[model samples]
Target: MSKDFTYTINSIFFDENYRPSDGTRITTNFANLARGESRRENLRNALRMIDSRFNALANWDNIKRDRYSVELEIISVDIDIEGNGQHFPSIEMLKTNIIDHKAHKRIEGIVGNNFSSYVRDYDFSVLLLDHNKDLGAFSVPDGFGDLHGKLFKDFIASDSYQEKFNKSPVICLSVSDNKTYYRSENYHPVLGVEYLPNESSLTEQYFKKMGFEVRYFMPPNSVAPLAFYFFGDLLSDYTNIELIGTISTMETFQKIYRPEIYNANAVAGNHYRPDLKHPDYSLTQIVYDREERSQLAIKQGKFAEEYFIKPYRSVLEHWSENSAL
Candidate 1:
């Protein structure tokens, strides 16, 4: 895919009146900047944190504390799903373009995990929270995320995408604490042990339809494992700096979104497990209400169902029936 594959905000493509909920991906600091705040201090501070973190880790050359300069651009991408052969509104994305000093070029490109849906409110929150659902024997439909899967496939395969990006997009996700991932010998220098889950989760299955495979890697000196979705050799496809760019960015988000697990003040080790009820030490700089985030996801799912899903229920059902693999 040597074309300009620009990743548009698919979250808002399905709805015209869609507004980014307070709990969506992208830093809350950026959201404040979008709300007519003329001062750029907050945005500056957030960006500073990224650069600082990256500099502390980019110890390729000891003489230079900051070997690489990092900058983030919130690019707006408008991707059209050619499955419908039509146009939808452009989506807003807080895209992170990780640049390295040695390379002096863009190393890794990724969108933060929130505002995370190509279709306004995605199942990221609602369905994923099922990891905690105490309900016994509850079942999700086989076709549950087929629509998103199909739409995301077209989103990546679209002409606009091929023209805007040079490589397949990378998605960063978390390893569920409820599950245990056995460490494997296949490991890279930057990304530590490769952990394999007992089985694929529903989240992994649906993501596969969007042309992504899963990798469980906990970076060296990191506390826990993370679930990364992509289409190529995560270990060999990119340079160490490129991999670190993503690792640093995603870990920053996880530390903010899930401090209880990812952010503990202790010696980093692979066998570590977070005691959610009480961590040895977990501090949160930002206010991220997981409960509220999940609740809003339920609300958005209903909105999508009423506005987009039900109205085209028959068409969707037919698509699902014929497109099953």
Candidate 2:
């Protein structure tokens, strides 16, 4: 068997108003606001629709043994107009709105008590707030390092986070702007052992000892360019099996999916290897694991377009057959 590689998977969520030029909410016919429905109720119904779509696409039978699963954490927030002097409500306000009001609490409870609860069955979940200049006003309570840490410690630390996930996983959230959104070069560096010096090699050794095949991809260029090339090579190698990874835009996906047609490689820019001349240093190279790759593939827009759409198409085809019976 060929040596197995490790895949680092990441995902981001954009609200209805995600465009770069202006902060505006896009209207959708799918709005859940029915007569007499509270805003929270409407939000919950919309969330349920999203959850159903995600769950339908992530059916257990479709999960391959070689693939690792990671669920995209759903981020919930109201659209705020840019240049509004009003201090947008803090994360605390958001939480309070969900937890304090009886009706909102009930709506949240139905969705799952917290972010972790909402995604407990999967490996991990993250709740992200869109990046805005006024975000700092949404302060973290004292004694916590930052908003991210506080939310993780408080919400995820509850019983829900401790519950046994189908797989052991890590979760986190971030605020991003337009510049950081589309470019793989701007993607946050992989954390844990992957970034630690001499750690990649050690992790590979550990995995090898555990009876897993491991192959590291240590390109002589920067991580972003390497990532781009790696994905290209990966898709070519696994044409039979679907390949996945995250990108900022559908255009970006189209470019990578068919580089020959789009000339995305030209836009891919330069290759940069980490500046570690010393051989026996702290940083080490780790390969992409199959399971992680599978999850990454889905999150990165691969499965979203291909694997996910197929089941829905099939179900639509069979709907009349079942309904007539």
Candidate 3:
């Protein structure tokens, strides 16, 4: 093996001009939405489905309490790869921007005025691990921490991100663990984890040194936890607080509507049994994992409630009441 090959992976999200880049074409939902003359209408319908699913997770029937609604935005993040000896360590984020749309209002402390989202290439993360079998768990080479730090620092300091949002954005990601993790107390499924780079976590330590706050949240009913990083006071932002709910809902939705893209095995496409020669050859499961996904949504929603919503209940209530006016 040459030990050197390079390639670019596009984000699943849309770009500034509201176009799906070359990379987004692999996914079924985005492609279907981009098809035909009714893209906007299709998008609206999809949003409605997502919103409805989110609301279902809320305790709306409670007469004494108020409810919160989440706003969703699709943005682009392009990663250009210049393959070096270790490709994952050399990948660089080139551009990132939110799609142009009427619904996208520049919320203070949420999205920047330049309308950009986070930029980093994690698509090849698994491939990197698989390729570097020689290195095994110690595959993350030197300078990886520096690269990670610079990417986040640049994103936080970027004109696109800093123009509107005064603080950092919340970062949600899957946990980096080979073993299946679960909540010790209840034995229920969790999808997130709070990662502190103490002696236990080198990745967390790298991010902590770079001024990033890391937490992991696993979806409800999931066998393991994913990592979520908070860059600023995301727990206090009413609108942004809906982020947890939004992400959990959309991911569950994908599993149902687009099983081919679902991270079913938690390794991203492992369950699909893709044949490299036949790029489109996916041995997708005939039955959707609706039960697991629904349970995940419920658990994820509750997790958000305790971690984000409940802590700031009074603030959220006040915002809800005021926004009604």
Candidate 4:
């Protein structure tokens, strides 16, 4: 049976009203920059784009209407960057935006304090996409604007589908190029491969220790050595895990578990070097490389399956055992 996936898009910018300084505008012309829309509208449009992409990739016809339906929501959008020099907005900013926007009150049902904590100090955004509406809302600490305590209380008190998604395991995936300053000390630059397991590994372990079933996947050919780890109960409808980085890892995992989830491409070559003042290759080159890797995965087929199936299952079983109280 096809599994339902809910995908949400949280923009790094929250307030459409917030505009960059005139000198800081990167576009050739600042016409649109001056006519910025409301933050809510920008966020809604972003979510729509994300939904459209998912629809195209999954092929609406291939999706099982009864078992799979896609839902989109904006957890938060951060527009202000402060302190860390990171261009992304601060978590506090997101929290403030949500409260001001009254999103907590607008959501049908809210689960817990997770959303509140998301706007604290973390620099991430979460889009919870699952067949289960109960499990759709997620917040990342630094992803939003600001954390609002009173707003959180109001949200939890609201009627959102709180029970349905209570404590559902959330997994985060970070994909990057193999060559980057963040690589570990012993990382190999020549192979363009480094074992930088998912940034969420420690978090995944913490969830497992708390009795949630967790699984982590690292794309062997991932540009940044990407990793994906999931946390949740086994034997649930959400059994199919999606690995969206390297083709080799995707094929390997799919062969073993017949996972319904897979990536649209391989590791993004320049993903790690976003700061390059002037890229040597055109953006098209990066896109082509990603496509080639995906095609290769499709061609390799069963052989690729042989590599990932057994090991993947073994690791999952081990995680379950180790995590069980």
TM-score of 2: 0.21
* Candidate 3 structure quality by residue, lDDT tens digits, 1-325: 1112222332333321244444332222333354446656555555454444444444345233224333444434332222432212122121112121333443222331111212112212332334467764555544444434544454455454455345555544434433223333322122232223223355566656446666544344332344555566544543423443535444443444444333344432111222223233233222333344334433433443444334544643453344311
308 in model 4: Cα distance from truth in Å?
45
lDDT of 1 by residue, 1-325 (tens): 2122234433322111223454343323234333223224433444555676667666767357666655454434543323443333333344455566665676545543322553435454454345348756656654566667765665566666666566666667777666657777787777777787877777788778777888988777777787888777766666666666667766766776677667877643445444555456576445445565556556665555565556556765665566533
> Each prediction's Cα lDDT score?
0.57, 0.23, 0.38, 0.27
Worst 10 residues of 2 by lDDT: 89-98
Which candidate wins on lDDT?
1
Sliding window of 10 residues with minimal summed lDDT for model 3: 112-121
Question: Which ten-residue region of model 1 has the weakest summed lDDT?
Answer: 10-19
**Every model's Cα RMSD, please?**
6.0, 22.9, 16.7, 20.2
Candidate 1 wrong stretches, greater than 4 Å: 1-45, 74-94, 99-115, 118-136, 267-275, 319-325
Candidate 4 residue runs with Cα over 4 Å from true position? 1-41, 60-70, 73-162, 173-229, 233-325
| Candidate 1 steric clashes | 14
lDDT agreement of model 2 with the native: 0.23
What digit string (tens of lDDT, one per residue) describes model 4 on residues 40-72?
454344333333332333333435322221222
**In candidate 4, where is summed lDDT lowest over 10 consecutive residues?**
91-100
**Candidate 2: segments with Cα more than 4 A from true spot:** 1-147, 167-263, 267-270, 273-325
